[model samples]
Target: MEKLQAAQLKKVLKPIHLWAIAVGLVISGEYFGWNFGWAVSGTIGFLIATLVITLMYITFIFSYTELTTSIPHAGGAFAYAYRAMGPFGGLIAGYATLVDFLFATPAIGFALGSYLHFLYPQIAVIPAALVFNVAFILLNISGVKESATFSVFITLLAVGELLLFMGIVGPHFKLDNFMTSPMPFGWAGVFAALPFAVWFYLAIEGVAMVAEEVKDPKRNIPRGYISSLATLIFLALGVMILTGGITDWRKLSAIDYPLPEAISIVLGKSSALTQIFASIGLFGLIASFHGTILAGSRQVYAMARSGYLPGKLAQVNTRFKTPHWALVFGGLISFAALFTGTTSQIIILSVLGAIVMYMMSMISLFILRVKEPRMERPFTAPFYPVFPAIALLISSICLVAIVYYNVQISLIFFAGLAIVTLIFVILGKHKVQILIHTD
Candidate 1:
């Protein structure tokens, strides 16, 4: 009925800040969740899966960077899809991005809680998780620069902790321990472990979601994406090898705080060194939890601003210039998820959403190349169609693998998508026109 103007995001992030947020949004995976793959595929099988996913991310980030820079929108994948494939494509990408970031925040929040519980036996998981969710939401609503600055500080601490973990566990890394039950479920195990492998780098692509907040996004976004990917790849592989080789994978496979458990084996459970590491390691979870909340709110704000969701969600705080409503709404949903699902379950669902988004984004890359050849791309993806094609093919295979191996979660994911689609058809179509006028 009335025109809805898009709320502008503050531009305060530099290349380094963007890199920190990108890596911060995913560094938690290095600490936990990924060991669950060991339960399904053992160390080597999961390693294979991780390597494949690693390639997919490398190609996906490089290609996705082109879209982020060329479009330079806070909507990330949704913006690319909407430009390339219209409303339906935009809806799919937007919803998947929301699901991925929203679920991931809770998973990391649960992890932060578990780490705290480990330090203080009197503290319970759910209460600690709720505190984490609420505290970060407040911090994010305060200011984008403040949030990003906090992320950078904590991310650096997490990186240092990971390096310390490697130094401590390196000498204890026995090849035999790592090789034990490397493929207990055979080839099928690798397929089953795909979701867990995906967790290792799940939300790294979210850097694009903050494109509007970045200064000189065309150059900075690409630098942030590439540097963060390189750092994550090194950290993920090192963590997996050292942690798995230090103890029986089974011990850490089902836990939310795998890095601490692995460290305990090296420093002895009762050692003060073990306690310190565990407590300090909580920074890793904090980094991801806080960073993902920032990303999720931006996605929610973008979708709502564009008329896919309630316009109220896009409202920025006049004093702070942040999406206060979206931040709080996402935090509430994350807390609900924390109470309902285990970290591994949430991680699986988050990966499923990420894979779907990746597939759609890659498709958008191809379509835009063919249709808008004249469009100015400040940063072109190296090797053009090849990189995006590889990313698309791997994402499709992973999606099929996830559906085949995780039927229940897959069904739930699709069911949620269906409900969202139904709502869009009935109500969102009318609002979709608002985006045209606003843009």
Candidate 2:
């Protein structure tokens, strides 16, 4: 948490921008991934899962904001864990954050591609994804203000579109529709639905990754996290429920574009508005794609600055103050993922990274309370032990569920993590440069 080198990211973001980034990082979940829950659990089982995961996020964000405001580092969970648990803890969180965001970009990029091809059949999916992926990397390299500004614009459009969707689909609601085979496999389906439920609010915590760039970390970070969580809760529930009632939840469950398909069912496939709404759905995917690229690169920059990664990745562009090399490196991984994995597998990998990081962050919060008793915490987590404890317990349970359900993908993620950890140990960089806690 020392002052970064001569070049640093500019602190130009306000509460509004943080809200934009927070929500934008996650808005795509509302658009596409969550519906996959129905394929496994049916509508009611997924609803139950979503509610439970939403509780985890509510408590986690409230508790996590304390870490963000107190430390206010670009590393987010990595910064908190390094202070509390030491270098090994930092590496764990660092790698997990990278997996969480880097994989997320290509997932959204793939969505953008599918969404575009749905709108105009002439353009193919993977190539369109590659084009959008490269565009966001370059846009992120340009500057932070530009990135946040785009986040605000695209996020508003995305949110408005969701709201519009809910309004239009609301009239089609029927309890009978939602309750149709609500649990195809009983409680096991709810257990299976956990990952898709996590999807609803997955990357909202990325807001913390940009804490150092906030205008007033103490006040604005809390405002951003809480407000954005509220917005997401409303949107997630409204969209899921309304869309479920519009048609057989099974039909929408398997498609990449559920909302538009619901609209086509409620209106007509040939309706002009259906086409426009489907096209506008691109805004949500782009928001997440661009936002994750911006936030993920900072993890690269922060880890490099602290000697966990190649120092070259830490270098901020002299003209724009962006992490140019970090962005490029992340873009390379994302493009590689674009070619290799299916979207659901990529999401499972990202969720695995996130659930582990959530566990680490909550554990760090507990350790810091005892380790640095007098640290200036501008905003203390309400209910102290309860909030973070609940968050940790739920995240751990979700982690087990995901790993058990997705054994193969989970193995791949852990194998990569182990390799990275081995290299980190052999390098012995942990002994060379210790992280200094600002507190």
Task: Please write out the lDDT profile of model 1 over residues 270-350, one tens digit for every residue.
Answer: 989899999999999999999999999989998888888888999999999999999988988897898799888899899
Q: RMSD to the native, candidate 1? A: 1.7
Candidate 1: regions farther than 4 A off = 1-4, 428-431, 434-439
- Output the number of the lDDT-best candidate: 2
TM-scores for all candidates? 0.97, 0.98
RMSD of each: 1.7, 1.4
Cα lDDT of model 2 by residue, 1-439, tens digit: 3444536678899999999999999999999989888999999999999999999999999999999999999889998998899888999998999999989888888888888888889999999999997888889988899999999999999999999999898998988999999999899999889999999999999988788788878999999999999999999999999888877789988877888889999999899999999989999989999899988999898888888899999998988999899999999999899999988889889999999999999999999999999999999999999999999999999998998899999999999989998998898856664654342
The worst-scoring run of ten residues by lDDT in candidate 2 lies at 430-439
Cα error, candidate 1, residue 289 (Å): 0.3
Off by over 4 Å in 2: 1-6, 437-439
TM-score of 1: 0.97
